[model samples]
Target: MEFRILGPVQVYDECTGVLIVPSGAKQRALLGALVVKAGQVVPAERLVDELWGQCPPTNAANALQAHVARLRRLLPCGEPGSGRPHHEWLVTRPLGYALRLGDADTDAGRFRRLAAHGRELARDDPGAAAGVLRQALALWQGPALQGSGQGTICAAEAALLEENRLVALETLYDASLLAGHCHEVTGELEELVVAHPLRERFYELLMTALHRCGRQAEALGTYDRARRRLAHDLGIEPGPALRSRMESVLRRQDPAGAAEGAARAVAGPATGTGPVDEARTADDAVAGAVSVRMLGEELARLRGHVDRLTREHRELAGRLDRLTSSPVAGPRDLAS
Candidate 1:
């Protein structure tokens, strides 16, 4: 049986799938409240505020009674079996209700315990860390209640659980990297960074993994992206750790620091020569092709022009020759 808080307060019984939350906002709120304080007491007044916030409806205690009655029907397996006809996981308290989880079970609780163990194993035996974290992660079939907990108080609880989930993921990634499984961390890290642009740790892990994989340029680019995102979204640079990591990367010092640095210098100004080289190679394949086309057109025009000019020059030369070769003819011509 699983009582989820990350989305909505859900009851998942292995034998009975999902249990329905009784109708009415107060009733639903009771289930959520019970899940939050699972295995602990939730005072009636606290349930009132959690359900109605600052302005609870009249007869709030009575309303709480209705919720409990409904939830009681859905008692999880292993709940305390009293000698009396009624079994009580939620016993009548002097002030409020107590959800007895020993009588119940929750995936959330199991997941958290597993995550704790995984974190403990992260620095020592990463394989064991991966195994534990994976088990913890596997407990989440989907977002709690498929995003059912969007209410004011419910959302808060959901967000808290989600944060823990991400933390577990971070530890998981660390373990994977230590186990020399850097390649496997990319997909998860990419999603995490996108989902949480302000989280510098995710960026750090991403940068480091990229560096370790010999993708130094990509690593630095990732850092630049983090800087830009933080500046754009939060009007601040990446926190100290990320900024420090970036500096080390640019200087090619301590490339293997706490966070990975690709150890590559920042990209320099490009001269557009990559395209130029490609164009030059392609044009060389058809050497002088363009010049030949132009020359062909110019040659036709020049040849015709030159022939006409040459014909006129020959005519003038013939007249000059007559005067020089025939002396008398030349004198008579001059007289005429």
Candidate 2:
């Protein structure tokens, strides 16, 4: 059985190709809450809060139990001949309930895994990175948990999934550009910049794509628009990366090195071009070298940040595992 929570909550039976979806808004919300934090015990009170907000009915616990039981009947059991009950997937604990699942059992989990693989491969092989990221992106059906109602937990999960999807798209575009597909991505980058005008990185990328496609004037125009938007909306200038891209565009310097080589081939030697052209070429070369050095330094800094974040994530996961491994008192336990 595979669970899909990238959009609505759905369970697919591998053996029979049947979809088992929980009925009602509350039941789906309940399933979403458990699946988002899969393998952890969610206290009854927490489930109740997610299902009905602060104004839960007096019989919320009984209502929750009914939903869980209904969901169990709809979920898939283990292998065909196995005596295990479908309810085994939804384990009951003294504190509350845990939705046990293996890796790659849920679309969200699968997306994370594929994205991580793509990132790891991106530094070595951009072509492979683009492929992996494309596969990761193919998993999303629509807005995450679209039918899932507006509860605090549901909203938070949806936001997180959307953010991840955007990040994956950005990564895919970066890899595509590196693989010499700048012209191919220009239209998509245009749409992305319009949708996310405040995102300096997207503007920087769009500018690079335009410049590479020999649309230098349009690239400069894009930078001007982004600069104005940043100032008007955030009251701040663009960051170093975006500013460097703008300068590179104005100087006719290639951020990715291809255009520079092409220019050299077309212009022959520095001596053949007139004095003014030679001087301009010399200045562009110096600026390009400096920009490349700055970009290298910035990349190193970002890599360090990625490493630190990876460590922090691992530590947090370890702490969460420890917390969930041991049972804790719930609201009912406190009441008794």
Instruction: Give the top-scoring candidate (TM-score).
Output: 2
Say what the RMSD of model 1 is. 26.7
TM-score of 1: 0.66
Give the alpha carbon lDDT tens digit for every residue of 1-336 in model 1. Answer: 556654445676655465654455556677776776777777888877777777778898987787788778766534346322333567778988987765456777888899999998888899899999999998876565344334454566667778888899888888888898888888778898898888899998888787677665577778879877876888665677986665444444222331221111123214544543444443443334433553464466558768989999998888778777884675567564
Q: Would you estimate the TM-scores of all the predictions?
A: 0.66, 0.74
In candidate 2, what are the lDDT values of residues 152-195, reduced to their tens digit?
A: 77789999999999899889989888888998999999999999
RMSD of each: 26.7, 14.4
Worst 10 residues of 2 by lDDT: 253-262
Q: After superposition, how far is residue 296 of candidate 2 from its true place, in Å?
A: 28
* Residue 317, model 2, lDDT: 86
What shift in Å separates residue 229 of candidate 2 from its native position after superposition? 2.4
* Distance from true location, Cα of 204 in model 1, Å: 0.5
